[model samples]
Target: MTETVEIARGPYRAQLLALGATLRRLEVPDREGRVANVVLGCRDLDDYRRVARYYGATVGRYANRIGGARFMLDGREYRLPANDGPNNLHSGAPGFDQRDWALEDADASSARFGLTSPDGENGFPGTLRVEALYRMEEDGLAITLSAQTDAPTVLNLTNHAYFNLGGEASGRTILDHVLRIAGSHITPVDADLIPTGALRPVANSPFDFRTPKPVGRDIAQDDTQLVRGLGYDHNWAIDAPGRAATLYDPESGRVLDLHSTKPGLQLYSGNHLADGPPGTSGGTYAARAGLCLEPQLFPDSPNRPEFPSARLDPGERYEHRLAFRFRTAGSVDEAFG
Candidate 1:
């Protein structure tokens, strides 16, 4: 049975749908606690039907990329749809991001969704069953994913939520926000944005975020990676003893810290955003107006032997957890002062 959980904070309201165990919307207070729905999402069920690009949604069955829409398993080559150029992106033609999920359970603070994929779905070789959990805590939100397969299969999952701390329709870009990534290297991508299977040091490159820096500081640098992706859309290799990457908006004293066990985090500055569609904030989205921090295995991990394996087999369960904790930097009186 499908269910919905309502989480409210003042005039802002969020609905967590048990279907697919997704955090469908998160309407929250901005810098002024003025109540803004910052996350990119659809206004209603019909809007989701018309939009294909998964906004504020859960993505799975391989969340990143697979080279040539094909991979060899046990000496057998499996061909996927090759949706992105010469490579397979986000799990071929009909990825899980757009599928309707079964609701397993739900409560005031949490929800769970489940789905079973028949063997050979999307050219993958396995009967896979996956479940995702969405939890709303006092701090922020926590997403937990688990999956198992009757046969060996690759899996990677992530939530694609676009955030704008200044409030979604505030008409300000994310240029002024400060970001700090706890990493020393990054997985360098090829001309087509596929990982070259090599982890390069972020020491001198613009990818370095050892210390707090503005995302736009060196985004326009004449670097190959930046030029290829149009901005910061590649994954950063997190340092060992992994913890969380942080983003702070001084204007609102709002901070979002992301913690995950995943090896890589893709920082997308929303360079492809356009004003073609109406957003949840009741305003047209402009480029660079928001950002996405997706934690997961490296792109094309099935093809990269050195990267962490994304394979799930019978009796072996795949699990990962991510937390997005929100906090205020100052006291209420001081913040208002």
Candidate 2:
């Protein structure tokens, strides 16, 4: 395995690897001027390859779930690998997360990684070309993803980074992290965690994050959605793509402002993160050890006509922009200000 590439600017520093175009480390400072590694992962690249967990990697051909591991495209049915029950999760096993990307360019402030997927690979049509750009600005990290395919194919790409703002790998969880999402609706999943093809309102449910609230505030409610997700694994329908969500850690005084152009944000509470390898921060992680806020198109969008389309044509190019604005402040307003 090759060495990881690191980029630094101001108080923000990040480590990137060509393997899956993954982010090996992301360090940010708090109000006391003390820095902590917020992103969770092992120190070795082999651990990532063997573990197969998305971690801080760039996940694609399709980022989330696809119902029945199948989709009908242009009157043809395509069957994908059933890696997640009867559904396809993160493009199935040995998907993008397990592949090594080629380094197109690298510098102190940014680096670009690229991958080319052949037709019929992973049971998806088209030869897909994808690029991921990781840039370190003065206050945040920006990732711009672009893709093109030789044939019409479904694609939804996103970074699967698990975050722990409270600054510990063991007993410290994300329960106290105050989070606010600009979503008024969500694409609820079923027993298999596949979207039910409905964009239901979040007005009176534990899924509401329009206003700031603790992550564990309603996670244990008797709601069926909560029970189905195990925590907050469902995708929240985001309207203002400019302002997708905002998360703050009272203990560390660290704030992360999420900005994306995607239609949905998957807020996973790391319910199934148990029995994982020891983290770089030094602990055997358990459930709720971290939280993931993945911004992308809705899961199972290929089969859901009502949701935004994820199809890319021969002459068309797909582009997505995501930014995690980080700062040390008392509240969300100060972080943005």
Candidate 3:
């Protein structure tokens, strides 16, 4: 049976749904103690059916792209579906984000979803078993992803949560929010936004966030990657081990701290957001209204040797953790300070 885990923190209430093992909603308080849903999500399963972009969903098998939808495994070429132009994005034509996962366990603070992918399901040569655990604590939300393959294969899992700290309907762009990543180099992408197998320094470029900077500070600059993605959608190589990146909203005095064990973090400023129908809060989503910080292996990592490996073999368990902690600041105190 499907289950829902509801966890509460002050005025904030979060519901972890086991449908796809997704963190469905994260309601947090705004400036006036009024709670608003900050994460972008679909209200029902039908909404996800119409839009397969995996909003607030857990993506797996491979979270990003695989070059040309083909990869060499054990000296043999495995061809996958070319879903994203000429590359295989987020696994293939039909990834695991939309599949109904089994609820393995659930509690007041945590819930686990498990799924097994048969061999050759997406042209991957292995029987992959994966689990996604969502745990909400008084401090924040913690997501732990683990997977094991019966044979050799590639795996990269991440959550696609679009966050707007000022509330979804606050009618403000994330440009004013200050962001700081714990890395100096970023994987440059090609014209199609696929990694070009080069780790370039973020110095003197819009990718640089060594210090706290607003996302819109250099987003519109004449940068090739920015031009390709239309904004910040490339992965930044996180140099420090077990470090956390932070985004602070000065207006609401809310801080979102992202801690992860992954080597790279993809900072996507929702440049393509548009007002279609109304959203959860009956607000129209405009461009740059939200941002995503997906912590995982770099995009097209299987095709890039210099990047961290995404290969999973027998007797090996792939494990990674990401935490999003929220802290409130008093009216007189600085949010970032």
Best by lDDT: 2
Per-residue lDDT of model 3, residues 1-337, tens digit only: 3355776655667776665677768987655676777787665546554666566778878887888898887788988889889988888646787677888887666778899989998898899999998887777788899999899998899988889888777889899988888899998888878888988999888888877888899999997789899999989999886755788787887778898989989999998877544566666778888899999999987777788999999999999899888876653235455
Error of 3 at 102 (Å): 1.0
Could you tell me how far off, in angstroms, the CA of residue 312 lies in candidate 2 after the best superposition?
0.1
* Stretches > 4 Å off in candidate 1: 1-5, 8-13, 17-21, 30-33, 330-337
Model 2 spans > 4 angstroms off: 168-171, 331-337
lDDT of 2 by residue, 128-201 (tens): 99999999998889999999999999999999999988765436888888899899999888898898988889
Using lDDT as the measure, name the better of candidate 1 and candidate 3.
Answer: 3
lDDT of 3: 0.81
Tell me how candidate 2 scores on lDDT.
0.88
What 10-residue stretch in candidate 3 is worst by lDDT? 328-337
Question: Predicted candidate 1: what Cα RMSD to the true structure?
Answer: 3.3
Q: Provide the clashing-pair count of each candidate structure.
A: 1, 0, 0
1-337 per-residue lDDT for model 1 (tens digits) = 3355775433445676544345666765545665555566655555555555556667768887787778887788988887889888778646776666787786667677788878988898899888878777776777788888999888888887777776677788887777888888889898888999988999988999877788889999999999999999888888853455888776777777788988889888989887546776567778988888888888988888789888788999888898777765653333223
- Candidate 2 global Cα RMSD: 1.5
TM-score quality measure for candidate 2: 0.97
What is residue 30's positional error in candidate 1, in angstroms? 4.7
